[model samples]
Target: MSTPSPNTEQMTSQPAILDQTIGSRLKETVGQHPDRLAVKSTTLRLTYRELDEQSDALAAALQALGIQAGDRVACSLGTSIAHLLVIYACFKSGAILTSLNPSYTSQQVVSALRHVDVRCYIASSDILLPYKAPVSSSTLLKSVFAACDQDDGQVSVSSVIVVSNGAPNEQAIQDSRVWAFEGLLEAHRGRVVEPATKLHQDDTISLQFTSGTTSLPKAVALDHWSILNNANVVSHLWETTCEDVFVCTVPLYHTTGITALVLAAMLHGACLSMPCEAFNAQQMLRAVVEDRCTILHGVPTMFQAFVRLRYSPEFAAHDFSHIRTGFIGAAPIVSSLREKLNQQLNLSGIGNAYGMTETCPAVAVSTRKDPDEQKFYSVGRPIPHATVRIAARDDPHQTLNVGERGEVLVAGMLMKEYWGDPERTAAAITTTVSDDGIKTRWMHTGDEGVLDMQGFLTVTGRIKDIIIRGGENIYPPEVENVLMQCPGIESVAVVGIDDEAYGEVVGAFIVLTIGTVISLIEDTKSDCIDLRQTTGLQTANDASGSVVLTAAKAREWVRTRLSHHLVPKYIFLVDELPTTPTGKIEKHKLRTQGCAALAITGAIASER
Candidate 1:
């Protein structure tokens, strides 16, 4: 028999379309609200007119230096007015903007730069100093410092611009290809030139790197339409308006900060406030209170830090009544923590958004007006112009029922493609034809979730994060949620560890609340207990007898709330949970550490 022809009908279309790029939108806003406050940073503040004109000047300078359309310009600076300006400049000049986390080490930055084939490298003084020695001989530096020879094998950066407020680096000053950010602006003063190439809405605007938890970070190529439309939906969901002020607590490199916070704010003519160079709990809280910010955006860990600081005497003096709404995502949020955040942060409402860098970062988001249960427990319905469905883990063609747990499939406003990696992009995105002849290309989220009848989504866990022990599947978030209700537990992460008999078993790493104590009792069979006691076992032997006893209690705690197979067999107490730069608990790291700790303590043997 011959294979049947696939359906050619297209999936449902968006009700509305955005024809303009983010740069065009900025220009429109500038024309309408020239005097409106666009951004406020710790060191500088800019209005719409100033931001547009300044970015225009920088774009002219970059164009004069030979940057052209489709060329990639990488910014390795923290959240500042200069960073925002550079972003707009890249957009205005029709150059692709690639953001690198300022926290990245020199080696990591170099690897990223090589992968993206960056044309221009921009950084603040502090961020550039660390790379001066390592990248000194690279093409980027050789442009400025003729003494440094460039290697033909390396993908060389053409120009380097350092934004410095204090003393300029003598080395940077002497380099011919390098220029001070201030000098570039001064050089192009009053010279505003339009981009050489005409930009379309579908033109690639940015290449954002993923957090790279499981493997090397992939560069997601986002078009102007995807980003701008996604931001429009997110801003509307947050009830953002021209009168509101948004305080950004996340780094600009992340999707949550750029698409959801910065771009969303601009789309609605809302003011954006940068608390500090990076996320500082005190500084963020002060910004909220001082700027009278009506909205706030952060990951769960950032909000947790704020809650911790809320108890301090210094925090009591600050008034957070101005915070009307906030967003918490990029990690699992338990109900208990959600309640505490709403209360402590004085937020009238809180939203939970879910997406990856591949979807311009937001496919599903909970609105402020959603029911408490949905807002706190579920990552609400798909945003407008987007479609989401649950499919069987092993088969993409088989769609699951509303309540059945499966991999999440999203369509609409998806990334153009993963930059320079068509193989991986093809693997992540697949086309499916329905019985009715509707065809849709879905982005396989690789995340496990269940969609209820009301269309709300409950993300169970990552497909790889599921713990299968003795033929039973265990979702880590299910266990983590139950464990969070236990007293004295500040944060917890459940991971699967190798087991000789069961293939894999549940293991948990927990962080205790400050000042909470766990009493240790020496096991008579262990001779090292005495040595451990002398070495401050509380800080050192997190897998000691005391931890084992606490583990027993935790297992019991889970036993009452979850299935017997779901209870963690091994538990380790640590001062802090290992997290990525974006504040997500690094489960793979925990799995490695937990396996080693279990081997030394013979916890696996006990389980057997």
Candidate 2:
């Protein structure tokens, strides 16, 4: 057992709370700024009043189809104006809105539908094709349609609304339960309906799924109060105002895009511009320049891709002077890369936010006025209505002092529960008694971090990412941060592979930057010559002699910056790192691949 810190009492405190629902907030914003630009896509633009009226129409139509309060409505569409309308319509109907990534394969989509009892699924014509073609053959689709045909009390998908930008597909129209999105809108064009039940702050509003990297995704239930209050705090921290124009490049399926960017903009009456249906660095840059966008939000890799565009000759065609503040999250951001982004994008400040899907995503965020060092080194302080602490990793009951690395715990802002999974919910959140005898429930984040005296947080790594080598705990980020600064290294992920001598050993998978050259040693055989160093190669090539040489250099670089035990024992060169739909690196996949590669080479012991 670990010892509880003396300052544990001081670490626990309350933040201001606001009681509001997403629908009420939208109504308030429309009343305050009826003519303000609320949302914009490449071809469509909607003012506050226009958006509210359209959502009201859609809400009435949904009610006509038997959707009621607390019903689950899932949307599997790209990020567009239509997507936003569906989100607000669900809010007005008091329905729980759940989103599915359009990029998901048919089987993955079927799996998600099976996991949650979705009542109505909204998709674009492109996305609905797969389901409509084999409606009778697909067990999932047939079951859903059959349930709709009968008046059964069981909760099941009753309708699939297909949103088409142009003409509706004839094949899709053949299905009895399937309906065209435009027809639904036109049928109730001027109609509006009040929700059956009064909207409450505590009413569940969303069922977001976790990015299933290691296991199947779990449904996280978030209430109106948690999401609205969290968005209010995040927008305030970003200094968002009515005049701020935000360009959203992240997908709406993720909380970062919806709660943080979409709802935050709505809370402040700010304009939101969607650059494209999906993320495109050039399109995002063009949107910022064309729309005079003042704010931007994306993960680190998205920003990295945008910065790389600066090297293109056509980069001068767009002006980025209007961009002032933005948010970066979903992955680690190295200090050096952060500096380059700030310098290249000409951003006055870029904040780093930290949270999971369950927190409605922004528990902590940096301010525009924060120093460069703070922005680079920490994920800033907890937003209003949220508190954080570093608890002992092995013993959750014991809280650690400032600067001591341990599991990160959060309070105040949290999910209502994991939808229909009480056991998992109970495991993640725990009730604890502070030193003063006050009781509180903290979300046990499973992530490792340290807190500074100033209340800033530095996330070290995931608890699962810890490598236990020779009885010593080694965090991959510590070593990764160092290796990232080395020359020619583009991106790196470190994982633990099973070892005979040391229970587990560190393995690093590296992606080299374009144009990086690895000179061959004079004595190397003809077959061993570096064939992977072709200039202008855009994608990752097979592991060759050049990869071996680059890995050797990387090992030496780590030896100089970290302890001997911290250095990676094996290194593999790859084209790119596998990522979840949300852009987070999938380290578990790397561990499996790394172990297999090590075994094939018979280098488990010799590599060291």
Candidate 3:
């Protein structure tokens, strides 16, 4: 069976279709301010006029190659100005641009290409060279080409255009279907301008693949309205202005960095600083100080790295008074780490963000002036133009009362559908009747949360992550939050293991800071603190009359302070916890390891 082409006319019927898509808006903005810099990297900078002209030329070239609207173009290029231009060109031509992870193995890359049904691929020569099937299957990929090298000497294997003059890899560049990027752009320079077409609000803009805890990663299709609305709402909530310069250290592939930092910055005409590499504490500090950046966005791990650098005299010497807001997302931040950031950076806002890729990357974010509790404990209220409510699990039509935790239902600015998967789409969205027999639909978030009387949203847990010990229910995040408060602990994740006596036993995986074990042991040996003190508990351990509790004893101490069911029965100390490609801990993998050791039914159950 052949794939159905996306209907362009249906987009005009949606009420939420904005005045312009990102490309048209950029075109208008470029005509008005031609000389202004639209994007900049360490080695290159392009004015608005240049970027617009280049993108238009590239679009024309793509059309000449028989590429049309609804076509999927796969790009495996790294961060560069030319790559950004390619994205704009794709948007202008009404084609979907899907970015492939550069680090993906051959098998992973082949699988992704097959899943998206890529028509044309732009990457580096090395990437295309020695092209062997990563998997044993028939793949219908068409044209493949290597992108031009940039001034920085960093090679991008999947870029559509190459800018530098280096000898091409003979083996990879031999395909008759392959062509140079510069030639393609030149070929379409004299072509007639393509008029702007009306883009539907529900038109899928991008497909982001996210790994579920149990199953393989799922491709999330975010529509134009969902993405634009999310960016606008988050920009308004944070009071982002045109004059603000944002320093972004997070990778562009991650949703938080892509939507909240890159896309949001472009929407507001704010200057964004994106380093060519991953977040390095010293390099980031240097960028912030030199760029005169007012806004900073990163993950909790990045902030922790920066705080640790503050102890160095050279790092402490740098001034950070220019930073007005420092936003942290992608991971849970402990109280100590938050406090340290506030003290050292003098941050006006130390915020948190919570959302899945299916929710346009950010459903809620804390403002600069919001209280510390709101920024840390809760993920803040739903942004304007978005709605959140708790609904009964079995009855999707029923709404729960305020302050009652239930499944989270998100509506307004939600995705149009999961691409090529109608069954998944139907399962995710449920139909309901509003007042006066009016029918409506809501996207089931599959998360558990509650809304306060003030309308502030508090996410408690994922419905699947809840641990039921005996008859009592336990949320791993709540326990992990408390466990992270331990003086020597750097990071922790709580999971359920099987037990014969109890249906499941809570297990704590902990990673300590450098030399924390020695420090904790010495502190215990000197009688400066008890075992409870080391684990951040108020009560002492009463496990067979041991004064200094080990990892196992600490669990007993927590059980004494809280309910027995809430306590973790086993504790495994490690150097670091395993994380997914997007930075979340692979809890499903951990649960599998735990279940393999024992026999946890819930952990062993097959999940779709």
Model 2 worst lDDT window (10 residues) = 522-531
**Candidate 3: residue 324 lDDT (0-100):** 75
| Residue lDDT tens for model 3, 60-143 | 877776677777776655445556666777777877776665455555665665577666566543322111222211121222
Clashing residue pairs, candidate 1? 143-177, 144-175, 144-176, 144-177
Candidate 2 C-alpha RMSD relative to the actual structure: 5.1
Off-target runs (Cα >4 Å) in candidate 3 are: 1-17, 31-33, 124-173, 182-198, 277-282, 518-564, 597-608
Residues 1-608, model 1: lDDT tens digits: 42232121112223356779888899888888889999998778889988888999999999988999899998877778888888889887889999887766666677777788888888776542211332322333433233223455355677888877445445544556677789989888787758877899999989998844447788999988988888887777677788999887777877677888888888878899986766677888778878898888777787888888886887777657767675777887888788887777665477788888888888887767778888777887788888887889899878787678889989988998889989988988999887999888899998999877677888988888999998888888888888887876888888998989999988877777654444344322111121122134443245443323345566678999877888877666777777766788889988887766656566645775
For each predicted model, how many residue pairs clash, with residues at least 3 apart or on different chains? 4, 1, 11
RMSD of 1: 5.6
Give lDDT per model, in order: 0.77, 0.77, 0.63
Question: What is the C-alpha lDDT profile of model 2 across 171-218, one tens digit per residue?
Answer: 443576777777898898888769999989888888888854347688
Supply candidate 3's per-residue lDDT for 38: 61
